[model samples]
Target: PHQKTVIDVEKDILYQNDMLAQRNRGYFDAKNVLAINLVSSPGSGKTSLLERTLTDLKGEMEFAVIEGDQQTTNDADRIHATGTKATQINTGKGCHLDADMVANALKGLKPKENSVLFIENVGNLVCPAMFDLGEKERVVIISVTEGDDKPLKYPDMFHSSTLCIINKTDLLPYVPFDIEKVKLNAKRINHQLEIIELSCTSGEGLPLWYSWLKSKVLAPEPV
Candidate 1:
């Protein structure tokens, strides 16, 4: 019965996490905050994308960031450099940020009403997929240099994510990555996944990303 015990413990953990996530979701709803969880592997350019996003959208909307890392606050520092309020959650040995951690961070972040809260999850495409941190939307980024078959390799992450960001497109000419192949592979895993190709350096396809964010904020569904 060891396997059964392990399964039971896993279920208990998820059940507790789900409860906390619902509480977190309710808090976000009460504050009218649009929370987006950004997940990806290391060097996927999540920080760069957020830096640009906060910079370009400055004076347009109130924004806050919860940067997750296993150790340093470097990412949060970078985000703060953009003049956006940011809190770093050092997960220590944990590979992923759970609902409890996010709920605790929320107390300090205190993102204002009608503002956007971006949670840059730990740079891991594995464990993050199983934890729901009470986000209204989830974005997964994969750099072109990371190969085009990421969707097939990390099906859980791609399947759970609502949007897939293909970053580092400026190097596409040099890389053997096929953008269309990535889209097709991801779609095969998740037909509803919205894909966007962007280059943080060249500022290509960013307008569409911004427009998508605006539409989600302006037309948020009932909580």
Candidate 2:
């Protein structure tokens, strides 16, 4: 009897996804749009960071967002409230956003040339790590309320991400999260992982985050 193993099917799925991702990359390159994929566990302040970013940089640079969630357009509504163009993809039972999904969303978003395109992926660290959406950078957000051992627990996510944002710094005084420990653990998994600490509530460390985004937008080709 003919049979296919789970690994075989998984490999085929990833290969197909990667191919589509490359096509998305080519499109972004031709359009001169800087796309960033933001992945994180739920309630990690990904939406808050984006809201503040869009509000702060509204006049300085044009930005658009593609929000992925299991259901509801709540996050996209928040982004729209900040006056940024946004498209929402309701993944239903899907755990993560794939390149094909982003490609479809881009059609409706119609992102402007030379603008920043942020993809707020579904709030799951594991699945998103396996799907590259042809973004210039993959950013993982972890709030201070979460354990420092998260990087160790989710090595694949940390390893695949280009940058990690340690958010909710204002809660550090109340929470037991250790920034140094988180950094050490993440670095052990990914030596080249760039990290930034910020508090979206109080605006601390936000300038550095904004600077990082600006740099990426200026470069746009993955530096």
Question: What is the Cα-based TM-score of model 2?
Answer: 0.95
RMSD of model 2 against the true structure: 2.5
Lowest lDDT 10-residue stretch of candidate 2: 214-223
Q: Please, what are the lDDT tens digits per residue for candidate 2 over residues 1-223?
A: 1356777888999999999999999999988998999999998998999999999998888899999999999999999999999999999999999999999999999998888899999999799999989999999999999889999999999999999999999999998888999999999999999999999999999999998888887644553
| Position 44, candidate 1: lDDT | 94
lDDT of 1 by residue, 1-223 (tens): 9999999999999999999999999999988899999999998999999999999999999999999999998999999999999999999999999999999999998999889999999999999999999999999999999999999999999999999999999999999999999999999999999999999999999998999899889444566
Candidate 1: give the clashing pairs. none
CA RMSD for every model? 2.0, 2.5
Residue 45 C-alpha lDDT in model 1:
98
Off by over 4 Å in 2: 1-3, 219-223
